[model samples]
Structure formats: C-alpha cells, structure tokens
Target: MTGCLDDLDITMVEEGFTTKDLLETLLKEASQRGSREAFFVADLGDVVKKHLRLLKALPRVKPFYALKCNRSKEVVHLLAGLGVGFGCAKKPELALVKSAGVPVDRIICTGPCKQMSHIRYAASQGVQLMTFDNEVELGKVAKSHPSARMILSLATDESRSSGCPSVRFGATLKSCRQLLETAKDMNVEVVGVSFHIGSGCTDPQMFTQSIADARLVFEMGAELGYKMHLLDIGGGFPGAEEAKGRFEEATNVVNSALDLYFPEGCGVEIIAELGRYYVDSAFTFMINIVAKKEVPLDQPGSDDDDPGGKKSFVYHLNDGVYGSFSSVIFNNTCPVPILHKKLSPDSPLYSSSLWGPTGDGLDRIAEGMDLPELHVGDWLIFETMGAYTGPASSSLSGAQPSRIHYAMSRVAWQAVQLLQGKLLPPEEEDQECTCAPLSCGWEITDTLCVTPVFAPASIM
Candidate 1:
C-alpha cells in the first residue's frame, strides 16, 4: 500500500467529488428515502491518509486506536487491516475488536479501574497488557491475573492537559514508589509506565514532562527488579485540521523526548493510545432543518423604533444534544456549520441559534451564529465529527442516532487491496463497482463505493 501511493504525488486520492458535492448527493438521496434527521459520511480514504500522516510524523511510536472515539466496525476493521492495534477500555469494545479478528496480542485493555470480570475475561482471552493507577486496581489484577503484564499509569501535569484525566485517573509521582513496591510484593509484573496528558492536548511541553515522569516510574520499577519494556503514552492528540500545527509541534516534542529518554535500541517498546487523531476529520455530518422561527429584536441606537428592524432566527434541527451534538455538551465542542448551498457575499445575514430536535432547553446546537437566512428543509453540515460524536450520541426524545455511510475512493480501495495482499478482481481493475447489501439504505456508485456495515444498534 505504501509503495502504490508513494508513486502518486497527490495529497488525497480523488474521490471524484468534493465534500460539498457528496453532501448534496447524499441529501438528495436521503430526501427520497424520507430520512428526516442527520446522517454521517465517512471518507475511508481520508482515514487511511491520516494513518499515513501519523506514521510519517511519529514513526517510532505505534498507535493503539481508542475504540471509544468512533466504534464503527468499518473504521475498526479498516484500521485493524492496516496493521493498527486496538485500545479497548470496556468489555464490549474488546469484544468488538475480537469480532473484527484482531489478534489478542494486538489489543490492549486500558482503563484505570477495570471490572474484575473484565480482568478475568481479558486474561482468559490472552490480553496481558493492562493499565492501573491505584492500589485497589493492583489488588484486583494480582488476584485475578497474577501473570498479567501491567503498565503503571502516572498523573500528568494538569495545566498542560486539555481534558485533564489526573482528576479521575493516574497515580501521583509521590505514590509511584509505593505502588511499585506493592506490585513487587504481590509478584505482579510491572512491565511499563503510562500517562495521559488528557484529550485535545495543546501544550507540547506536556509530552516531554510526561515522558520525564514515565522515566522516573521506569527507573522505580527497575529498582524493584522488574524489567520495564513498554511505555504507553495515553491519548490526547488533536484531530482537527486547524490543530495541524499544534499536532506537529507535539509530535516533534514527543520524538525528541523519546530519543532523550528511551533512545533507539534502548530495549524499550513505545506505544500510544490515540482516539481523535485518527478519525476526527474523516466524517462529515449533515443535519436537516426541520423548523425555524423569526424573533424580533430592538436596536437601542436605531432611528427606527420598529422591533422588526433587527431579527434573530432560531433553527430547529432533527439531531440535538441527545444525538450527535452531544459533543457540544460533553466534550466542550463547538462545531461550526457549513451550508449546503454557498451564500453570496451580499446575502443578508441574521443572528441565528441552532437548536436540536429535543424538547429539553439544553438541546441547543449553536447559539449566536451569524448565517444567511435559511428556510426549513435546508441542511447544516459539520466536519471533524468522527471523534467523540457518533459513539456518544443518544436516542433520547425518540430521535434516532445518525447512521454512518462509509465511502472509499477508488484509489483507497486499491490501497486497501495492496495492504491486505489481495488481488483486485479482474472486472474491477479498470472499472468501479457498486455493491451494497439489500438491507442497507445506500445508493453507491462505481467511483465511490460504500461499505456494508451500517451503524450499530448501540454506540459507545
């Protein structure tokens, strides 16, 4: 797959349609099928490219994809096929990865406090790599899986973490010695150290500091007569295009830190658990505008006293806080909207507030947005939605969570075939193919083909 794409000078394989073009096509198709709510369009080609980018930027570290980000089987299967490992935090996520045919060794069960049953199940399934930050968890592991390989998780600098996990997980520096001693006493193997700088991390220095902290833990374990070989740098990588500069900065810092702390041939294997970095920009969400209301506003300094002189528009969409927009409330996400139809520069703009379909007052999508006046039936699109969106959406208020539609460019499929060491069908060598299961509500063409896996009945 690398060789096939290395010869091509293109940044992204031409899928024969821009995002707007594909959005329009899908909107038309959804209208015909009577889909009143939002749906997702996943560009598998983009996802593959992101993986390549990660390899280029941080070549030394292997990434274990966090399934909590986007658990679509299609995404998981594609990553697994591409040789990416899986990071499962829950039993179901582990089951999903196992169902995708991922090797037991390629999966890591990563949660600070894991269920006893889950620990037993993982041990039974041959998943030896797990994480712990507290004494109780160590006790659980020692009793349930004595021979299990463990990674000690340390608390990161809270100021550097965007979504700080120190408050909930991670052992402090002062507590690391005691934990290692306990593990040594219990005869539980402490084979590595791990720390999360939090999700959506912005400070590159955080990584260097975390690495320094991990080094301390590594030395502490070594003093306890344990051979530490693994260093799990937990997830916090940003996945948005706007964060490219920050990501690069952080990657450079991580590379430098690895060289300084765990240099080449140091007998230490490095790995990362990245969630949003792999899939955030690979999806585009389209939501339908079901209703709208015009609110009259009075301008304090206007010569005309008519309240109608200034107006604010309220838009009601089929998906809301309980649905894909849950990220707005949960992740502190602020998704910007792109209209299906481009508005003229001279077009009138209004103060608009986008609302979710739910009756709850907190189900708002966006407030005080400046947008061209839109009518009912128009669509609002959100990008960089693949992370922490789909899996977190709920079916509250009778609003079904959005369905995912996977589309891979022709070049992407070729890359997949190359990576999997499979020959392209003779008939499909020069022509595109449209294949969809009868049960799915998709109309795929030759150029852009859809994967058969639809949205699961339940999300993460």
Candidate 2:
C-alpha cells in the first residue's frame, strides 16, 4: 500500500489498497513502464469535490470557475459534473466549456478583449451574460447581436489598479453610464453591473469598494429608468487555504455591500466569479528530482568594490516557472515543497534555490529559499498547487506540465459502517505501519511494513 497514504492518514476502500498505497503502486509501475519525463497527475475528481465543498460553504454565492485558471478538458468536465458555472475569457474556453455539454446559460463571457467572432459566437450560443466597459463594445454588440444580454463593468478606485481601466479593461463610472444608456438606445439588454479589483487581492475592503461602486452605478442606472437584473461580482476569490483570510474579508465586505445596496428580496440575482480561491489549494504537485547539483552564489559588495562569493545548494526539479511555478511570479508566493524521503529530525537544513529543467536563465522557479538539502532521485511535493498550477504552467516546452494524481476517502462512511456491523477484523487491531525507501511520485522500491487498508478504529 502507499506510504504516502499512511502519511496523509487516508484509508482505502479497495482491499489492501490505501490511497497512498495505490499511488505508490502506480508510481512504481509507471517508472518501469512509462516515460521518465514529467507529467502532471490531475486528480480531476478531487478538484471538483473540493470546489463543490467551497461552493456549498459559500451559501447564496454561485461559483463561476475561471476557465483561464486551468483549461484542462478533464478539469472542465469535472467542474461541469459538479454543476459549477464557468467564467470564460475567450472563444476556445467558451468552446471547451460548451463542448463539455455545459448549457450556454451557465457560462459567463468574461475577458477584457472581445473579438468579433467570439462575441458573435457567444451571442449566437445564447450566452445569458457578457461584460462590456464602453460604448464601442456596446455598439459592436448592437450591430452584431441586438438582443444579446450584457453587463456594464464600472471602473472602481483606479488608484488600486496598476493601470486602472486603462489596463485595457472595465469602463469608468461615466463611461459605464454612457454605455448603459447606449444599450438602452440600441435595444441591447443591460443586465447588470460588474467590477474586478484585480487578481491576487487579499483585502475584502477592495471588494467592498467595488461593491459600493457598483451600487452607485446601480443608482445611476435606476435614475436612467433601467432595472438591472444581475450583479456579476467578477472573479477574485482566493483558494480555501491560500486566500482564506482574504476570502473571509471579501465575503464580509460583499455581504455588507449587498445589504446596503440591494437587501434580500431585491429581485436581483447576485453571483461571484471565483478562480484562484476556489481551486488553488485543492491540488498538489508531486514531482521527482531528475537531477541535483551544487551551484555557487556570488555575493556582491554594497558598493562597486568587493564582489566576494557565496555558495549554496541548488536542486533542479522537473517542474519550474515555465511549468507550474508561474504562480510564484504572479502571486509573490512559493508553494511549500516537502521532502518525501525520511530524514533525521535534527538534520541541518540547507538553504537552496529551486530551478526548472529549462536551461534558460529566467527558468528559475524559486531563488535562494531555505529548504532541506535534497539529492537526485528524491521527490518534492508542493502542496496547494491546485489553482493556477496546471493551466497557467503547461507549456509545449521540455516535459509537458505535470499530470495530476487524485486521492480521496470516505473515512466517515467507513467508520459509520464499521460501527453498525460491529465485527473488527485483524487488520483493524494491528498497529499502523508505513513503507520505506520512498521515491518521488511514489515509485516504491522497497517495502517496510504491511499497510492495512481499512481498520475500524482507523476509519472511524
């Protein structure tokens, strides 16, 4: 069975197969039977379940999984199965989600740029909601699809945006008002007001500010005799763990803003489009170290004088910035990579930098971070990689993006069933034991103890 599962404390359902055990078995077989190059193991099912749980927890808010995050067909299909709507940025994403049998009504056509073909396709597909920032787009929609439904995105706190509305997205309050009035004149249905506070935002007040801005626009729309039918709070929610504080703060702001603007029974449909917050932490990247080396570091003097030298350990992994580490570049955060092989608790930790397989100078994933000195053939597992790691990192470069391997267990169910049956097996009474000689991605070269898949107490 998987020693990984033992560490994770997951019990398996199949006879003698703990979740880790199964992964171990798979890795063992794959190493011998499959390509050595990296591939992501997308546990499609687990990702969906986690998103569903988040959605359920956020009552009164619907999730429109940002398709720009991870566009994997498997991921899209799973989100569809979970009944989560999609926030599509372009034609391909729209096509991918639609191809998965997701009804057009369930998709929101989002994105700063709108090509004629994509917009026309969205209109023809009966997309219920699209966002626009200016009258030019309104005129385009009016010229192409007069009956298309759309949202007027209001620019909020330009000071907060790196480039503001000029970032080439969203219209100013004045422009939004003009756009809505134009929609009225052109017979286009202006359904709602939408705004984005940018991505990787952790402050809920930013959302509150956006909401307040939307409310002002709503009032403006009302003065112009328009009854907005929707409030599309565009994607910005953080993942369960990574963005928890931010999400909570944002939620409070949103709830208060909604109360202040449109109380319950206001007849306006409220929606939040979340991407990173919903999926980022639900996945992990498990990659094997293909090679390792000692690289020297140059220490430069504070001035133009002494350029003394420094030395540090560098571990090159299969995945890098061109792969799944783009989040580091974007989020200013590096995922924690834990060593899978056993080590002395007292062993001295070595500071090192993580690098990808690319020979390019910019291919470094992490630069000079403190981590255990690792060796070749060791496995490095980065947790909380579910969000932008997959689609954001995948490339037609050396070794395609890593594949995802999924694991889940009905621990509560097994416990309940065991109590009802009341018959304890020998495996249930035995002590817990895990495997040894661990390798990355779970290629088990040796066995230490026989792992019990199911034990009454353990399951409970």
Candidate 3:
C-alpha cells in the first residue's frame, strides 16, 4: 500500500475529475478526428539537438550518431540538420543517411557482418572510412577493395552491453597489431583505432581507462611505422540525468586522459558514436490505461499474510514489450510516467502493476511499480521514450504502430489558428505550434499578437 503512491491523495479534483475524463476528452475530440491511432511514435529532434550540444561542448571530439537507434527518416533529417553525421551499423543505414542528402564523407560505415556488396558500395560512394577487427575481414577488404580506408576496431573490456565482445567484433590489442601488419602488407590505409566501452556507462573513469588502452594501441601502431590519424571513442553516454553524471566533469576527465596519453602533433581526428544519449529525452509516449485494480496488503510477520488477501490495485495501459521491447529487454530501462494534467500533491499513491494491450503475462510493462492510482482510460505519459520507441521497434507485435507526429515551431495555438484561417479552413490544419512569448504573458485579447520563439542558439 505504501510505495511511490504513499503520499498520493485518493480524492479526485472537482475541476479535474479522474484521468479517465482527460483521456476520454482527448480520444473523443482529438484522436477520433485524426486518422492514426492514439499511440504516437515520439519525435527525437529535440533530444538529438541536446546530444549534439553535449558533443559540441566537448573540446575536440566530433559525434556521429549511431543510426541503428532509430532510423525514421524524420529523425535522420533532424540529426543531419544538427551537423551530426551517421555512424551506420549496416548497409541500409548508410544508404538511408546518404539518401537524406548527407555527404558520403560524413558517413562512417561499420558492422561486423558487413557484406562485400555494402563494402564496395561504401567505397564507391567515397565513404572510405570504416572499421574492421579480424584478419579474415582485413583479407576480405583487401581482396574486394584493396585501397579501402579502414580503422582497426579494438575490443575493450569495459563494455556493459549484452553483445560485449566475448567473441564478436573488434580485434584484441594483440590482434589489432596483427591486423595493422596485415593491412600494411596489403596496402590498406589504417587511419584510425576505435573502441566501444559499452552503453549505459555510468563510470567516467572507464573512459579514462579506455583512453589509456587506446594510447597503447596508438603506440603499437606508431612502432609499426603507421601513424594513425583518427581515434574513435565509441558511444555509451547515458541520456537520463540519473544514469549520466556531470557532463563537463566527464568530458574534462576524458580530455585530460587524452592529453596525458596522446602525443602532441599526432593530429588525430577524435570521433565518437552516440545513439541513446542523443535521442533518449526528446519525446514521450502517451498511453491510455485500460484497467485498474487495488488489493489490500497483509502483514508478513502477522497472521494475515495469505494469498488472495487484501492488496493494492494495479493499472494496465496499452503498449508493452512488443512495442517497446528494446527499452525494456535490451536496455533494461524503466520508463518513468509523469502526469500530464496536474494532480493534487497529496493525491492517494498506490502500488500498481502495468500491462500492455495483450493478455500475455510476459506483456507486462512494469510490475509493482508505484504511481497515483490510475483510472481506466487515463493517460500514462512515459518520458524519455524517444530513443528506441518507433515503428521499426513494433514489428513483432504487428499491432497498429504508433503514429509519428512532429511539432518544432513555438507559435501559440491561438496564433496558429489565426494564421491558418488566412490560408485554409480552420478544421484542416493539423500542425500544432508550441510558441508562447514570455514577454506577452499569454494574454488572449482581440489585438494580442505574439512573436515567434525560434532558438537564437540551438537547444541544449
């Protein structure tokens, strides 16, 4: 009975009613009017910008966003606008980014299982830079495109991801040296050394340690008479405030480590591949709760700790593992729900479980999660759903995928209504504007006009 809902008040607000009312309002008046389902594929443009700002703040490291995170054309276009390149993990990703008008030179094609066709295409398109691990891969490149430019990807021990190279991509330090020797013998230009320290990396010192390992590789490359010019520090930067520590401090430590190990005048192009950090916080998924239940709690040491005893109610919402399986199973992330509409600070809190639309027991989104007791048809707004929640992720569930929507402009709703009246029917305009000038204080009078709210500097 006591958890996140411990402080919640059970009384419904007279003006607000319950979450059901708000969802019913939106469904009847808003979603029904639109063609797509109520669920949305949240946009990541703002989040991409935030990640770019963080990258730009770093002294000399350039970021190439890992495109596999989410390959929606809209998301790719947004990242391109932010001056970030694509870290393509597959052939299609390279093609997708290139088709968006991003220059070939700006793309880095990398993957352990890259086919010869993809390699040839990348080489022909002037995307000369790539990564390779084993001698077989090096031989494959040499046989197919002898003059291909490549990086020797080294396997680092700090990675915390599921695929952390027990036997996958990236050569060992010894293997890196051997691969470099093979590349030199085959006339391949080994221009860089790359390492991935893993995703959701909370330890900043891991980066410093990885840098030290990279420098040892650099020294090896140097001894082999091959002076590499690029050092790619692979991505793992956390997006959430809790997982991610102070930005400046982390970057400072990385820079300091680089300075201590990298010799001056080496002139290496420092690059990083960031996926989650860029698009993680840019969007939210608003789901409608379908059911609710509350049970009484029993004292464990007392005589009343029996099954089917009094317990707390649980709330079920649409979209579960099948829709956002990556965030749950792959990333092990818990989506925090925020009430869009205001609730009393003292609203009754309740222990709750969350289920997706399907009845499968494994379809649970959260269990024993705490929130204000959600009524059936109330909305659960999941924040930081931008990174991997999109149509591409919903392939297995095969349900109607979340409809993607966008709103970058800041024009007030009234102002947008005013502007569209001159061009088209009021009912036909679907674009929503977010603009609200601080100077005006949102006074809506006959003569009230507001200015645009474009960012003078890009959003951080």
Candidate 4:
C-alpha cells in the first residue's frame, strides 16, 4: 500500500478529485468487478481530515482511537502511521493495536470491568494504564497486576447524558470517596479520574458538568495521599455532517471547561476515547437490489387500505440488520439512501420498503420511504456508516459477509504521501505493492492513478 502511494508526487488539491468523484468512480469499478451483492467503499483520506479537525477543535486533549468501532487493519495502520493513540477494551483489541506497531504507552486499556486474563496479558505486555469503577475490579487488579496504574470511572448526571452508561458502568458521585479509600487500602495506585457523558451526547453542558465532577474526584484522590495526573474524558463525539454543528458546540463548551478546570501548566494530562469521530463519514455501503415486489393499490373496500391508498414497493437487498445494518438495531442509526444514477426532476416517486436477504421479517431496512421507482440490478448507497457498522456485522443465517473496497481521493492520497515521507523509516518503506484493476480508477494530473483494494471480510 505504501509503495502504491510513494510512486506519486505529493501535490495540491487543485486537480479536483472530490468525494463525489471518488464515489462515482468506485460505483463503476464495482460493476466491472462482477459484484452482485453489498460491498463497502472506504475513503482513507477522510479519516485524515477528521484527525486534523479534532486537533483544531480540542488542542488540549489527545484522542485514543476506540478499537471497537471499526477494527479494519487498514484503518488502524493508517492512524498508527499518523501518530494517533489507541483505546482497547478487550484482549483482542489490544493485540490488534500492538500488531499495528503502536507502542504500549500509546495504548490504554479502558473498560469499567475486565477479565483477569486480560489484565494479566496487558500487564505482561507493559500496558499499565487501566480503568476501574468498583471494589471487585480493584481487588482483581491488585491481586493480578498490583503495579497497574488505575483510573477511577464515575457515573455522569443522567439528565445530561444522551446515551447513558451510568446504570451499567460508572460509579456514582457519592460513592467516589469510599472507592478512593478502598483503593488506598488495597495499595492500588490511583492516578486519575474518568467519566463518559454518553455516546451521541447532545448537551454540551454535560461536558462542563462532567469536568467539574472530575475535578472534585481529583481533589478527593489528593486528600487520600495519591497523585492524580491523568483525566480520561470518555467517548461521545459525533462524526456526520448533520451532527457536526452540535459536535462543534460541544467542543467549544469542552474547551472552555478545560481552561477553567484543567488548564495547561496544571500538570494534568487529558486524553479522550473517540470512536466514530474519525471514521463515520469515511465509509459508504453499496447494496445491490436482489429482488423487488410491487403490490397493487388497495381499493376503497380492501382489507389493507392505507390512509393514503398508496401502492407499496418491497425491495430486497443482499445486506440486512444481521450484517452491516446492525447499527440500526444497536445504535439506532437510520441510514439515508442515494441512487447510483441520477433521476430527472419530474420522475415519479412511490412508497417503498427495503429489506434484507433473510427469512426473518424483522430484517427491514427502511419503510414508507418516498423514493424514485427502482428495479433489480440497480445499486443503493448509504453513507456515514464507518463507525459502529463493520464491527457489529454477524453471519447469522450462514450468509457470507460483504467485502470492503478502500480508495482515497487525490488530495487525500497526497497528504498521506507527505506524512509517509516525513515519518516512516527507510527499511520499512514500501515492502509491498498491491493494486486493484478497475476501468474507472482515479487519474491524478495524468501522472498517477488511485485504485481500490479488496479487503477480506471480518466477522465480529
């Protein structure tokens, strides 16, 4: 992969290879590849842009990419090369990060409760940074890995949390002093405090409150004769454009709170666990229409007469709720559809319902959607799917999973090349060169071409 990008000269974006252009090219390439099912088209360049955006928004906080979001090695390798840290909740996730050559200090083992084996493995690997929220977990860490550096996890105010984890994980504010004393008694080193406002948090004030609560805990740890140097602001950053405004607002509020509570020269190191922020918009899922059924309009006296008396179009796709659409059920994400080809302004629309290629009636994707008339063999795409989609997909009915096709825009590719030139070592440079042959590939300045590579499916 490095060799493929190294051949091109690092250049500017004036050549105009936008995301729309890349998607158009990828659609054509998919057809030529003889694919008749669902596939993924991932833009590595978009991940790069998201990292830069995070830096601009929160210069004081460092992000540790959540490994449970999308565990594609390509995504991890790209982020590792760009010097991003990682957050792992399980042993496999920690191993994957290590396989990408990320050092132990750059990876933090973060979960309220963890297995003893996981603790032993992390300790053996020199991953000392971990989180705990209960006495049982504290005892486990003390017995198994007594040298571990622990961060106490606290519950957030539920009214401010959008997707709350309080019931399952974090400790309450009233319980903080007792837990700190217990840790002191167990001889476990309590060096920090952590809390998650929630996933998809809408209240920026939640951040302000969480930080203030963390400050109180920090003072408590100090009173217990412990040095509190780290503050882990857990994950909740939104990644899509519709939520970008809210994300920015939250960033501003968080920035103000950090300045007030944990400003620089305060000797406190702040880090965040961000999952969807870096990869959500970088992925687009393309599903092929496998079958279609058109139901006749109900008559006035019909048994199934809808209020609008509209006909229903049922379309079956290769992917479903058990697969890439698992986020629909797990994260409550509703993916918007886009046609592969443009329709005229005057094209007629009809009531449509999309379903997965499964025997289960519950595998519906969309219902009562007003879409232009569609047919078998046509392709439908859903964007902003890079976050919780891939890692949640399963092979529940013996259905083979879909493959991923990775490509980058010319501007993004150039940015990667520039980074590689400066960061990568000489011997490790371009040890392998691989490319996918496609007719509609990206041509940059007529001197370089960008092709998509097929990545094997990984079952969660």
- Per-residue CA lDDT of model 1 for 1-460, tens digit only, reads 2123323223332445555566667788878998766788777777766665676677788878989888877788788877789888899999888877788878888887799999999988899988898889999999999878988888887764556457568899899999999988888888898887766556778889889989988888888898999998877777666676888888899999999999999999999888888888888898889988876554321123332346677888888877787788878877889887677888866777788877678887777667788999888788888887752445464655687776666555555564466733333333444442222222222433233233211011
Regions of model 1 farther than 4 Å from truth? 1-15, 296-309, 391-395, 423-460
User: Which regions of candidate 4 are displaced past 4 Å?
Assistant: 1-15, 160-162, 295-310, 391-393, 413-460
Report every candidate's CA lDDT: 0.75, 0.61, 0.62, 0.74
Clashing pairs in 4: none
Model 3 worst lDDT window (10 residues): 1-10
Q: Considering every candidate listed, which one attains the maximal TM-score?
A: 1
Tens digit per residue, CA lDDT, model 4, 1-460 = 3223333222222334554565566677767997686777677766766765676678788777988889877788778866678988999999888877788888888887799999999999999988898999999999999999998998887564545457578888889999999999999999899887666567778888889999999999889899999998877877766686988988999899999999889999998888888888888888889988876655221225333346557788888888888887777766778898788977767767788888577677777677777999998888878877752446563466677777655545544554455422123233353432222332111123222221111101
The C-alpha TM-scores of every prediction are: 0.84, 0.75, 0.73, 0.83
State which candidate has the highest lDDT.
1
lDDT of 3 by residue, 102-207 (tens): 8866788888677888888887777888888887778888887776778888776655544344236677776677777888888888888888766645567877
lDDT for residue 266 in candidate 3, whole number 0-100: 66
Angstrom error of the Cα, residue 43, model 4: value is 1.4
